[model samples]
Target: MSEQGQNRTMVEVHRVPPTPKASRSRMWTDLYSEHVDRAATSLGDAEHCPAITIAQLGSVAMIRLDLAAGTIQRTAEQIGYVAEPTYAFLLQVSGTASFSHYGQDSVLAPGDFTLCNNAVPYVYASDGPADLLMIRAGAGTIREHLPSPEQFCGRHLRADEGLSESAAQLCLGVCEQLASGLPEAVHNRVARNLLDAIATAFAISFDGLITASAVLTGRHARVRLFIEENLRDPDLSPGLIATRLKLSSRYLRMIFASGDETASAYVLRRRLEECARQMADPASAHLTITDIAFGWGFNSAPHFARSFRERFGQAPRVYRREKLGVGMPLRAVGAEAG
Candidate 1:
């Protein structure tokens, strides 16, 4: 991905000294702590110098990494939301790399891909020289195109055939284009199209999987029904549901593995939906949005407001105002947990 070689387009290039192998791990650790309040480790020969190049396309980053046989890991202790949360999509270019995240593992060869969540612990390793294209996009930014990206992360995917092939081809072209330059508009549009292609591909793949298994469909339905019935329970969670349903938490999650979201995410969405329903109810206009949230098992007002906005595209106050008619204010409620 050097800026010099192939039919270079119109890119602006900057070069610096090669990063010293002995110091890179420390550098990455410091970077993680400073920005994301986490830690990362790079383990490889002291003489290995990684060649990394990065380009920004709108809010997403396209990076080319040439690595020696080594491992980069974020441990359980390093599991936390990034300063600006992102989902990392790694496309293997040449050689092989293995990625482990969300308790799943994928070994990638050329033209293979895997997705990783920045907020979770993960390991990326290679046995020898490897070339990769790493695409990092904000969590919310990704959801705009792929609503349940979790289903695709930490799993082996291909860029060689099927619907995903278009995404893989687009990404590879864009990565190469980064060395040369594309207009800002061109790159951004490329980013959007790539994401859209991935979402469509994943959706079709997921539908195929689910449609092939009636037992999975039934299990998922039962779990969801239980969640709906217990929406008002403050302690409702995947683990709790598993215990009540006599299923292992891992199995409970697996039932949702082929779906758009995990079991825990479904719980949050249900709670939010219930709260929205109450907020829009004429009789519940007497209650504040906070009250509605708490009634649906949310305990923290700030957390509720943030989650609501992310899901519904508006602040709770604004949503209520519009639902109740503009200029209308919520009536005060007694025992409001104020």
Candidate 2:
């Protein structure tokens, strides 16, 4: 971090390139624990440690993290050390990852970006070594003009598309400028511009679908959150949700109608995505395809297989094999043959 004034300091924290493996891992872990949280673990190989370089720009922070193939998660129980909630907008510079939060999951590639809530539990697992640019800011900065920010959490927004591209570019530029040193007034201006760019990116894409008035969008956000929180319930339905939320079924449907998918479709899609995510995880490998399906609210094996194929464009077992980079199991082959 470089400092201009007393409060305005640009501090950069990174691992010393030549450090031994164990010490490097410990250093990276300690750094993240201090700045980010203690929940961060080295996802690299047994001897390898992921490296992160963070630059703090007053209220907004930028980080360039290089993570090896593995997983990192922040649980709800870890919220105490997190202080106030902030919005972490991650821009995938290279590599692929499955980002999960708010009952939504997305596979992000280079030039793709997403929002993560610091107040909630979230997981980011890399398929391989990955580089990411994360801009952290107050939630209000991005949420002020963006309608239903929850809807976009963990949802991939293309950096090459519309205002999102501009925002990503702006972030990179701001970081570059700050790194080279700038006046305090210029730093503040750049920070404000970065926030505005983020707001523009979100509003241009999402706000166009709703109103500036927060009532309808706020209700929609709550509804989406409820759906995400209850996605595992097999009996989850718009009617059930409406009853629980003390709203009429018709109004619930109307609220979701403002967006793309219907309530039922959205629920099913999320369930399918979640099941797919679990199927991709090695930890869940002990669970059979049937168990995984049933665990995520799919009652009928055939129905689950059908919907899984429809949503993912392949059989669940096939998708699992692709994710694990292995051939089909003998049992799967026998089932297919039978």
Whose lDDT is greatest here? 2
lDDT of each: 0.68, 0.71
Task: Kindly provide the TM-score of model 2 when superposed on the true structure, using C-alpha atoms.
Answer: 0.73
Q: Which regions of candidate 2 fall more than 4 Å away from where they truly are?
A: 1-48, 70-84, 95-111, 119-128, 145-148, 163-165, 180-187, 210-214, 299-303, 313-315, 325-338
Tens-digit lDDT track of model 2 for 250-285 = 888888776688988988887887787767766566
Question: What digit string (tens of lDDT, one per residue) describes model 1 on residues 98-190?
Answer: 786554567899877777766665667787878887778898989898655555667777666467667778888887666666666576777
What is the Cα-based lDDT of residue 239 in candidate 1? 87
- Cα lDDT of model 2 overall? 0.71
Q: Model 1, residue 324: what's the lDDT?
A: 66
In model 2, state the lDDT of residue 312: 83
Q: How close is candidate 1 to the true structure, as a TM-score?
A: 0.56
